[model samples]
Target: MDQISGVQQYHQLFGTKVYDADTAFEFLTIAVFQAGMSWKVAASKIPVFKQVFANFDYHKIAMFDEPDLEAIESNSNMIQNGRKIRSVLQNAKAAVQLEPEFNNLADYFWSFKPDKSEEGDRDTIGAVVAKDMKKRGFEFVGPTTMGLLLVGMGIIERRPNA
Candidate 1:
């Protein structure tokens, strides 16, 4: 298996090479899925999510049917909780509403920039921005999860030059 840094791995997996709006949108949706679970588990199952949810295309997910829900529920590769599975579809639909006015998910999401003047004091990148996500009105975006997404997607540069 090919090995890369965590940021590289997330880029390989979700195309969030930088802190762009699209990447933030995907990370936000993924964070909702990540509630009460480990990102490693979520990361491993992302491909299944992509296949089931039409590559995380908001328009496509908004139109999912019962068959899609059923397939996701039965998939061993996913979290399989009915609520989390359903959230994916619902979040996608929500994305539709947000997209027309906002440039991308990141644009809306990052509108809430935290007080980062003291960012240099933060030992880790994750520590820097999860606080901002909450202040920004993002629900379910805990520091750790936000940190993971930020670090993984290069939204926040990784510590120690990873």
Candidate 2:
């Protein structure tokens, strides 16, 4: 396929190994961290994030001690914003807390969606941004960003087979 988009090209080139939710969750953490920054910058430093954050393990992040937080703050490859670093840790904690309440982090997250019926439609990708977001307590999760997140993390398959 002559890919029309960068992400599409990434999928075509990288294949489906990137489509797991755990990977998505980890990458989503990177995206959440990059909420206001450039994706190129975020993508460039993902290795640092992986090493410093213990591969985005919610169990570990939930148990992160002060030393871990300090280490994350001192890491040169990550965003040094103490607050953003803390947010990822906090979100990890939240993910852990959420796990017991559902099948998995992906289920808990997708449950926030009104329905999962149309998930296969790439053209409806923007529908992820529904009006119920604020009421659902999702802070930075908007439709477009969340959609990109689903793609990056492999939660949602890209076009053709999506």
Candidate 3:
């Protein structure tokens, strides 16, 4: 599939739904894993990821210790990237920290949604958000990852032909 359809399919499958902070974190985690791999490959691991990550509950994940990381890193069903696993833990901790300033991670992320008329470059907005997220202690959240995250969350519309 082309990029447009790929994004559309992803949005249709995962984004067209009401999402809480946990769900938002799930999508962000998917984006993290999507780096250096196809979305299909990354998506195929969602079930195992959900099972291992405590249903993407950032609170639970934030509390994960070394044993938890070791277990995940050793799991054959997971992507087996130690850095990505560690980043997930870091991102979870960052998400938990957002609870004080925002209602939840979802609230903090949705705050970046562009107005309908202001749907300019997705990469530009993604970069801005990525910068803020890095400052807030999230890991593995660069511009490209943030762009995919926004697309997966339906925070930004996908171009029909790009």
Best by lDDT: 3
Worst 10 residues of 2 by lDDT: 1-10
**Candidate 1 per-residue C-alpha lDDT over 26-69 given as tens digits, one digit per residue, 9 for 90 to 100:** 67666777788765656655556666777667677779889988
lDDT of 3 by residue, 1-162 (tens): 333443454446654543578878878888889889898877777777788899889999999999999999999989989999999999999999997799998888888888877675789889999999999999888898797677667788776663
lDDT per residue for candidate 2 within 118-151, as digits (tens), equals 6565335534432343343334555666666655
Candidate 2 has a TM-score of: 0.67
lDDT at 2 for candidate 2?
26
**Per-candidate count of clashing residue pairs (backbone under 3 Å):** 0, 1, 0
After TM-score superposition, the amount by which residue 151's alpha carbon in candidate 3 deviates from its true location, in angstroms, is: 1.8
- What would you estimate as the lDDT of candidate 1? 0.60
List candidate 3 stretches off by more than 4 Å.
1-11
The TM-scores of all predictions, comma-separated, are 0.65, 0.67, 0.89
State in Å the error of residue 40, model 3. Answer: 1.0
**Model 1 residue pairs with clashes:** none
Comparison by TM-score, 2 against 3, better one: 3
How far is 95's C-alpha from truth in model 1 (Å)?
Answer: 1.7
Whichever of 1 and 2 has more TM-score, that candidate is 2
Report the candidate with higher lDDT, 1 versus 2.
1
- Model 1 scores worst on lDDT over the 10 consecutive residues at 118-127
With a 3 Å backbone cut-off (N, CA, C), the pairs that clash in candidate 2 are: 24-153
